[model samples]
Target: MILELKEVHGYYDKSHILNGVTLSVGQGTSVCLLGRNGVGKSTTMKTIMGMLNPKEHCKTEGSMKFDGKELAGMKSHSIARLGIAYVPQGRHIFPTLSTEENLKVAARAGVDGSCKWNLETVYTFFPRLEERKDSKGDKLSGGEKQMLAVARGLMQNPKMMLLDEITEGLAPIIVDQLASMVQNLVAEGVTILIAEQNVKFAMKVSSDCYILERGAIVHHQATKELTAETRKKYLGL
Candidate 1:
């Protein structure tokens, strides 16, 4: 497995969020974490990225292993350096920075010290971003912002990407485009773990799916194995 979370637990202030959540993602494959709102889908991504620090009374426990190394106590930057990129929800782009600058600021070699994801290469992959290279982050459309967020993460040349709700609040056309982009990423051997509410898009991108409910995994199966009955039961689809 490229990533593994074993019996993980977390708290936000005094509220316990993740409850013994356990899951794994194989290298070079795409996986989905599916759930309804407030079911700890985003929390799982944050926990994996080491973003749920002890501050704000946020505490996490249990094992998070990446590429054979423990990530339970590691800092977020340290985890990033270990080749895990997180494209968080909300598409947190730098409002004042130009699109190109946002991508440049995040530019870094992979953990293996390979600079395969430079601006030119990334621009080639995301030509829309190149066209908006000079535009400020705030001026971009919602879909463009989302693309930039994913592109920024790619700047790190990560081995695995933790994508949290990448398709939220977008037009159907934009959603379809993003689905193709994710497919291309997977084709290029980038491991992806996406947390999503759009079951159709999630199933299209991921080979395997993990259903999360009330902060814990309720089911794990191949995407094809996810039936309508299961979706209606856990995801309320």
Candidate 2:
């Protein structure tokens, strides 16, 4: 497994969010955490990224391991340095910078300097970004912003990516495009762990699926095993 969380709990001030969430992402496969709003799906992503300090953003306890290395208490930057990249919930990008500059700022040499996601490589995978290379982040559309976020994360040349809410408040057409991009990334050997609400899109791209409810995992099964009955039972679509 590239990423593993065992009985992990996260808290926000006095309100606990993630209650003993446990899941794993195998190498070269995609895993999806599905749930409605405020179910700790985003919290789970933050916990794994080391963005949540103990009892601060959340009380982070339990094991978050990547490649068998401990990550619970490590600094967020340290975690990023360990071949882990994160695309946050809001698709936050450098609003003042051009698309090219945003990607450039996120460029990292990687731990071994063998990373493969350079500007031309990222551009090849996301042609929209290439066309909008000179546009400032604020000038781009929502879909473009999301693409930039993913591309910037790729620029880090991570071994695994933690993507939160990849398809939120976008046109269905844009969502479809993003889904294809995700599929292509996985086909090219990118390991992805996604927190998403779009069930069909999630199931289509993920190999494994986990259902989160009220900050806890309520159900889990392979993506292929998710039936209409099961999805309705857990997610009430």
Candidate 3:
């Protein structure tokens, strides 16, 4: 396994958000976390990223192992340095910096004998980014900002990526392009864990799916089994 969460529990100000949540990801595979609003989907991502300090009121009472190393109590920066790149929701780009600068900020030295991703490789995946390399992050459109966020994460040359709602409000055409790019990334052997409300879009790319409900997992199955009918019944489609 590349990552595993065993009976993980987390909270926010005495409010329990994750009730013994457990999941795992294998090497070079894509997994989608499906859920409606307020189901602790984003919280799970934050917990994995170490953004929500578990030691605080948000208690974490389980094990999070990545590549055979325990991850509990680790800081966000430390977790990031462990080769887990996160492309958060809303494409949190540095508005004042140019697109190229934003990507550069996330760049790190090569890891595990893999070559680091550079400007050329990012441009190959997102041609629009090349055209707007000099443009400020805030000046880019929604799709463009999203591209920059993904490119920034790629600059780290991470072994796995946690993508939270990468295709939320973009146009259908742009969404299609993003999906294609993700397919290409998977082909390059990058493991991905995507938390998405867009079930249709996720089903098109992920091989497996885990349905989350009220801070707990309700179902886990192959993506092909998540038909429209199943989504309508379980995911409130």
Candidate 4:
């Protein structure tokens, strides 16, 4: 396994958001965390990213291991340096910076003999980004901004990526493009953990899926086994 979470518990201030969440991800595989809104899916991503402070009431219990290294007490920057890249929920891009500049700003030196993902590579994955290389981040459409966000994370040359809501609030065509991009990334051996509300999209790209409800995992199964009836019942479809 490239990543493992053992009985992980996380809280935001007084509210306990994650209740003994456990999950794992293998190299070159994709897993989707599925749920309705406010089900601790995003919180799980934040916990894995080390954004929610372990100290000062935002408590985390259990263990998080990345490539055999314990990641419980690491800082957010340290976690990033350890080859974990996160594309946050809202495409948080620097509005004043150009698309190329945004990617450059997130680039870091390669680790573990991994090739550094440069502008050329990101452009290859998202040609729209290449077309808007000189355009300010604020000028791009919603889909373009989301693509840039994913590209920025890739520039860090991470072994695995945690994507939160990659296809939220986009047109059907744009969503299809994003889904194709994710499939390509998986084909190239990048481990992906995506938290999404779009069950159809998630099932299309992920081999494994976990459904979360009220900070707990309600169901987990292979994507092929997820039925429409199950989705309608558990996901309120």
Candidate 5:
């Protein structure tokens, strides 16, 4: 497994978010965390990225390992340098910066010091971003901003990507485009763990699915095995 979590628990103030949540993503495969809003899908993503610090009130517990290295107490930047890139839900691009600048700010070689992604190569992979290279982030549409967000993460030359709710609040067409983009990344051998509410899109992109409810995973199965009955049972879809 490229990423593994065993009985991982997370807290926000006094509110328990993730209750012994466990999941794994293998090398070069895509996994989806399927849940409704407030089901701790985003919390799982944040926990894996080490964004949830062990504050006085908020804390994280249990094992989170990536590439055999423990990530329970590591800082967020340290985790990023270890080849795990996070494309958060909000498409958090620098609003004033140009598209090229946004990508450049995240540019870094892989952990092995190999540079598989750079400005030119990333532009080629995301041709729409190439077309808008000179445009400021705030000027782009929703879908364009999402593309830039994913592209910027790729600029890090990461081995694995943690995508949190990337398909929320988008048109169906845009969601389809993003799905295709994610598929291309998996084909290029980038392991992905996506937290998503859009079941159709999630089912289309991921090989395995974990249904999360109230911070606990209620179901784990291959995507091909997810029947409509199962979706309705856990997801109410």
Candidate 6:
């Protein structure tokens, strides 16, 4: 497993939020954290990124391993430096910066002293971004902004990516574009973990699926093995 969480638990103040959440992701595949709102899907991503302290007040317990390295106690920046990139729920780009500048700012070598994504490479996959290269982030449309968010994450040359609710407000046409882009990234061997509330989209994009309810994993199966009936049963779609 490229990423693994074993018996993970977390707390917010005195309220227990995550209870024994465990899952795994293999290399070069997209995995979905499926659940209704208020479940621990988002928190799971945050915990793995080292943004949440499961160790605080000894209120959280679990093991988080990314590429065989223990991530439970590491700082967020440290984790990020390890070549794990996160694209959060909202498309938070530098609104004042031009699209090209935004991409340039995030350009850097991967941990192995190699970068697979640069202007030329990213542009090839997202020609629309190249067209808006000179436009400021705020001037772009919703689809363009989403593309830029994914592009910015690529600039880091990350080994693995954690994407949170990327299709939340995107239109169907734009979502189709993003889905194609995601499949292309997988073809290049980039591991991805996505948190999503949209079960239909998840069924289309993910190879492995885990259903989280009340902060715990209740179902896990290969997407191909999951029936449509099961999806409606869990996701209420």
What alpha-carbon RMSD in Å does predicted model 3 have with respect to the real structure? 1.3
Better of 4 and 6 by lDDT: 4
TM-score for each candidate, following the candidate numbering:
0.99, 0.97, 0.96, 0.96, 0.98, 0.94
lDDT of 5 by residue, 1-237 (tens): 999999999999889999999889999999999998999999999888888876656789999999999999999999999999999999998999999999999999999897988998888888999999999999999999999999999999999999999988899999999999999999999999999999999988999999999999999999879999999999898
Judged by lDDT against the true structure, how good is candidate 6?
Answer: 0.87
Candidate 4 — worst ten consecutive residues by lDDT sum? 108-117
**Residue pairs in steric clash, candidate 3?**
none
User: What lDDT score belongs to each candidate, Candidate 1 first?
Assistant: 0.94, 0.91, 0.89, 0.90, 0.93, 0.87
Model 2 lDDT per residue over 1-237, tens place: 888899998888888888999899999999999998889999899888887775454578899899989998899999999998899999998889999999999999766686689999999899889999999999999999999999999999888899899899999999999999999999988899999999989977898999999988999899888999988888888
Q: How accurate is candidate 1 locally (lDDT)?
A: 0.94
RMSD of 5: 0.9
How would you encode candidate 1's per-residue C-alpha lDDT over 1-237 as one tens digit per residue? 999999999889889999999999999999999999999999999998888888767999999999999999889999999999999999999999999999999999998899988999899989999999999999999999999999999999999999999999999999999999999999989999999999999989999999998999999999978999999999888
Error of 1 at 35 (Å): 0.1
Position 60, candidate 4: lDDT: 80
Best by TM-score: 1
The reply for model 2, stretches above 4 Å from the true place, is 54-57
Worst 10 residues of 3 by lDDT: 52-61
lDDT of 6 at 159: 94
Q: Which 10 residues in a row give candidate 1 its minimum summed lDDT?
A: 48-57
Number of clashing residue pairs in every model?
0, 3, 0, 0, 0, 0
